[model samples]
Target chain A: MSTTIKVARPVDWTGIFFAVVLTLVIVVPLLVVGTWAFTNVWRFPSVIPQEFGLKFWYQTLARADVWSSITMSLTLATTVTLISAVICLPAAYAFARMDFPGRDILFFSFLAGHAFPKFGLLVAIAGIFLQLNLIGTFWGVVLIQLVGTLLFMIWIPVAAFQSVDRRMEEAARDVGASPFRVFWSITLPQAGPTIAAALLLSFVGTFYETEGAWLIGAPQVRTLPVLMISFINNQPVIQYGAVLSVLLWVPSFIALLFARRVVNSGSFAKGFGA
Target chain B: MSVLTIKDVTKLFPGGTKAVDSFSLEVADGELVCLLGPSGSGKSTLLRMVGGFETPSAGLIAIDGEDITRMPPEKRPTGMVFQSHALWTHMDVFKNLAFGLKLRRLPATEIKRKVEAVLELVGLGGYGSRRVTQLSGGQQQRVALARSLVLEPKILLLDEPFASLDQHLRERLREEVRDIQQRVGITTLFVTHGQDEALSMADRIVVMRDGGTEQIDRPDVVYRNPQTPFVAGFIGTMNLLEGTVANGIFTRASFSHPLAVADGPATLAIRPEALDVTPAEPGAAKVHRVTDYGTHGLLDLDLPDDTRLKAMVSHPAQYRHGMGVNLTPRAVSAYRNNAQIFRSEA
Candidate 1:
């Protein structure tokens, strides 16, 4: 099938080749940083490290801030995940199913916020939190991350709920089931895999994100990304930032490996939208 | 008693499309009435309004003389079997049937017995534990039936319920549905575009078109005597010939058929089977085309003018070359009820 399908144009070939080069260039740097975390030293401008040991890993654990950073990252991600699910489920349903005045305007406003980078809101958001005396609270870090989490995660579930057949709900209503019962039984069960995928994506994505956490959060509420940055600044010669990167990415990576079902169903439900 | 009454009910959707315009019907208890129409003819919208899935823009609906115009579907004593089965895909057959009962908080023992009995009634006794998708299309449809039957609705409504099944399966399931309807004797209102389905299964057929009732008659009466040109054209395959009526006898274009019109100019309609091939006589027609349809041949007879009349004849054993065929239309019907027929503008 592949051989006889069609002749490839030069433009298509160049596009494919350029994409592969770009992916390799970006991924290889992250791969090196990951491998360097376990090795003893980076000798020169060589592709591979000369000395390999776990001295940096042991010394990085010796600092108590490593544990605090792990806890901070976990807490901020968990809180963001809970808030996103609670706030976004109803919002997504309202956007998908109901019709009111200014509905399209409201939806487009959400899309605008989603398009705007989180860094644009960082300084003003920090100032607001400081004035409210919530700067040192763990919940403060979560509030700073809330806007992006709702935009990105709610879009997935909104598309999921809309793809469901309205006839199914009508059929349930015809068979003596109330509207709420139909929503609970037929609608939500079908949306299970998408919700799970969105929850995982929001939590894991926020865990590794540095911009929101680094700018708005105070010193006492430092997340793993902020902690990792401070650790690198204090021990520039030790290269513990590389260790912290691997440490931070491992849990999220494992969660993602088992997330194929969630992604497959979420992507299928989220057709032509997110 | 009138089990269901739709009195002056009208549904005006957005943009002024009157889906069901001032429609009304009084279905007697235990009668199976089929609302028959082509798509976009407001048959389904009427059914939806009755089921409360749609709120009518005008008029009122009553079940057993109680007005339920604004009542939600679940609150009404009505159940509907959807065309696609609409079985709870995530649930097993057992839970699917017992869903409404469980929601109403029926006792577990009564729910168990009712579910078991209906499942057996639908010939899916052992399929209770199986997922709805795991079942065949026929089985899933039976599950839908069981789900609605468990509710014991005063009148059961079906929206092209067996349409998704194959021809043979649909025939068998409609027979099953009829038998169950007879045994339980609940009033039923089913909708279908297929004439054969409505004719064979319904106690009374309501033919709808252009948001109004075209004809409401029994199957045999409707087939033998159609009330309007649209009903005749839509219900079944009819060989129509354009003719004019003056005095009493109708003057067809080619051959003058002995049709009796009531008042003014008219059009006469004849079923293909009404005309038969006879031995060629002085005023008879000559055969133009013959289509052999297994046991019978559908022949088109050319008259003096270019007007060709259709006839259905059983294949004779000795049909040979140069054998001339005659035409005879017996016990046929004529309509001059409206001048629209001769206009030919519609």
Candidate 2:
């Protein structure tokens, strides 16, 4: 009889340290918010809530205003994802495969939006949105979200498409595939997951956006982040804000899982090299 | 009529590099021509222009007497095997082969038949269902070949297709490619930097250098009677000796030969195999180095005047370093300022 033996891998201390740090930095906050959403009465520096109930989660869900904010944020995020993907695909393709005068400078300029804090830029753009009568409108928030996500979508696929082999497209063309067909069949398929990653990243970015959504989407068209901010300021307890935060975190967590899967699939370059 | 004709083609890149310059060649139907050159010699650029991947800055390309210079690659009737094989990693073998036929809107039955036929032709009859990533390098190469040939293109262009394989596999694959090409009788333009590959595979060879055509002729003629010094030196190793030709007699400082050609200040080019070396008590040449392969060896010798000569010897074990040896030219090719003046009769 033959038996199989399982071998154990040595513990990675550095990885474990990073994992713990990440959990503390990210997961612990979510857990605290979730606990706060259920706690009827809780105090900081106390390990557990003195009292517990579902009143805050129930109240937040039943609010017509909260429902409207959720709906508006969802619509704005979907619109931004669609628009940014459409605009970023061609821009990324050109940056990856073509050469033009001042190309690097132009591409770098696309990334210049990240050099400064968004709060500063939103403050300056608030005046323009005000003059255009776009402040507090759904389109106004969507426009700001599109600009924020375009930099990410364009940059991600540019690096992804550059990693894709140019010879595949050339081979497709040699075998009678048109420019459109070559992109549809070769370039897009090879970089499909990366493009997906970009879209999900854009969706997540727009979903969690606070500064621009607060500055541009307040009062008239209340997005989730704006409502949560107002709730936190107006209410003495943090439970209502924690309830809204947990609701918003759900879709972002799902998007992150999908992006991680797309990245870890790692099957794009399997047959190219020996 | 020629199947393909490139007339005065020149490709000037954006940064002032002339990748291909004034290159012209006519490929007849069912003829396999090899473009042989070192790297950066513009051989690939010429092939790309034919395949429509590149557009020549100046000149025209025509197929079957119709101008295709302005046509896009997909509209041209050509197939190319890339150096990297470029198989679709995400696709199964069948999907990869059926992609072009599907683009052409062929019927399912016809696509299946053609795909199966080419799969069998390339010796991969049952490989259609396999994922490309699971296949070996040689298998992937065949799949790449089958993918292109299934389309039945009017012309086939191969760009160093076997460069990535092991040496043994490369030799076998190259022979398989030659056999398939001949059996199909497709007009082929093969690009290679290897002289041995060009010599073995091409019906006619086009020797290129510095984005220009050096010589274009049959393999035997290009080898036996090169038109220029560059062609002679580039095709294989050749020793260049400076001399003067007068009244059908060529004379060097310490050697003389009776030629049957014109008189001028000339350069003599002799291939290593054309020089006969033998041991002598007192000889003008002294053996400097000897490198032996299993079948043959190379003897690098120097004359008293500091002229270095290399000769191939069949009896490699008999030669040693710093030994005195006598050399006699069995045949010599004379070139005057890059133009061929004469070659000794065989």
Candidate 3:
């Protein structure tokens, strides 16, 4: 008779440990904030809230200033995404396909938006906005937000366009489609998914952008992130800040859902030049 | 009537390298001409020039007697099939075929009819609704061919269309393409590096080397009467012997043959089948290797001065390695300064 020795599988302790740490890192903050948003009274030394209700939610939603800021943020994000797409997509295509003098240098210059300390750059741009009499205007907010969008709009779409197969375009041309028709029919559709992913990133990034809006549109335009900063600083109630913080996460959460679908479609990786 | 004429078309890339230099070709109506050469031999560049994907640095290109030298590819009445199928993955097979016709603003019914007919012709009749990515490699290639043929262009250019397929598929597809070209009666220009493909498919093979024409002849003529040493060496297996031809005789180290040529230094090229080998004692050449390929056998022989020669024989089992053999030239083509000087009849 042959004896069979049973082998015991080793537990992945390191993997489990890291998974627990990561889960706590992400979930604990949200859990604490959520608790604060609902709590009416959680005095010092109390491990848990003594009283919890919907009072903070009602108070945050009732403010006219919070309502205006929400509207302003949405409008700025939408406008900036649209304008950035219109201007930067064409530039991205050219950067990907065409050759010209100093093209490499010029394309890399879009990175200047995020390469420096953004607040310092925003202060410098605020000086120009002041001289141009553009300070405290919505267009000033739009222009500054546009700067935040350039890296996502240009770099990602450039990768998307570059990944498109050129032979497909030539095949279209051989079939009697003009250059413009080939681009419309062949090139754009092939690059569409990745470009869509880039647009999502640009819109979500613009929505959460704070420095440009605060520096340029102060006292006139207050986006949600800018409003949340003030709410945290001035508001005596901790629930108001917590409520605003949760509100700030709404667009990002929704964007993440859409982003998952886009990533699953496999174009998101190509947009990052994978 | 010639459907396409390329006269002295040359492509000098910006770096001053001439990819196609003073190349000229004329394709008869309904004829299939092949530009045959090794890579970098400018066969594809010439095809691209005709298809308008490339501009010739100098010279003229015409289709049906109209100059299309400066015409864009879309404006030119020419269709090209690339080596890669280049099918639009976003569209189904049906939409891919219909796209060109729709651009020409053909009626919807007519577009459907034409697309369906071409699909049938390419043996993909019921594959119209299938996504391009779902089909096999050979199916994608057929779709590519169907896409070009449905346009009914004045000239068709194929740049190594069967190059990506396996050997068996390549042979089958080349025969199918040749059949379709004949059935459609469309003038075609095929560029390929496979000599077997050129010999089997082309009505005329244009042998090219170093961006220039070496020989242009019928397949049989190109095989039998190669005009240049490059063509002789490239088209098939040939045993080249360095020798001198004088007084109606060719002579090398220990071998001599009767020839009629004005001779100085000359290279003699002979096909393996054209050399007759006989077993002999203490012969000038010794059998080095023998390979039996079922239908025919190949014998590799080494001369006294170590010049190796290959001969195709009907019976390879009779010759043993290290055995002595005498070689007799049944037919030979002599070349002088890269050009064929004389070819003796068997």
Q: Say which candidate scores most in TM-score.
A: 3
Total backbone clashes of candidate 3, pairs 3 or more residues apart or in separate chains: 0
Candidate 1 deviant stretches above 4 angstroms: A1-16, A45-47, A50-53, A237-239, A251-274, B279-288, B300-309, B316-325, B337-346
**DockQ per model, Cα:** 0.65, 0.70, 0.82
Model 2 TM-score relative to the real fold: 0.88
Candidate 2, residues B60-170, lDDT tens digits: the string is: 998898899989998888889999999999889999999999989999999999999999999999889999999999999999988889998888899988888888888
Clashing pairs in 2: none
Q: Summarize candidate 1's per-residue lDDT along B214-299 as a digit string, tens digits.
A: 88999876776678877777777776666776665567654665544454566666777777667664445766677788888777
> Best to worst by lDDT, what's the order?
3, 2, 1
Candidate 3, DockQ to 2 decimals? 0.82
Q: Between candidates 1 and 3, which one is better according to TM-score?
A: 3
Comparing 1 with 2 on TM-score, the higher-scoring candidate is 1
Model 3's CAPRI class? high
For candidate 3, what's the RMSD? 2.9
Which model is ahead, 2 or 3, in terms of lDDT? 3
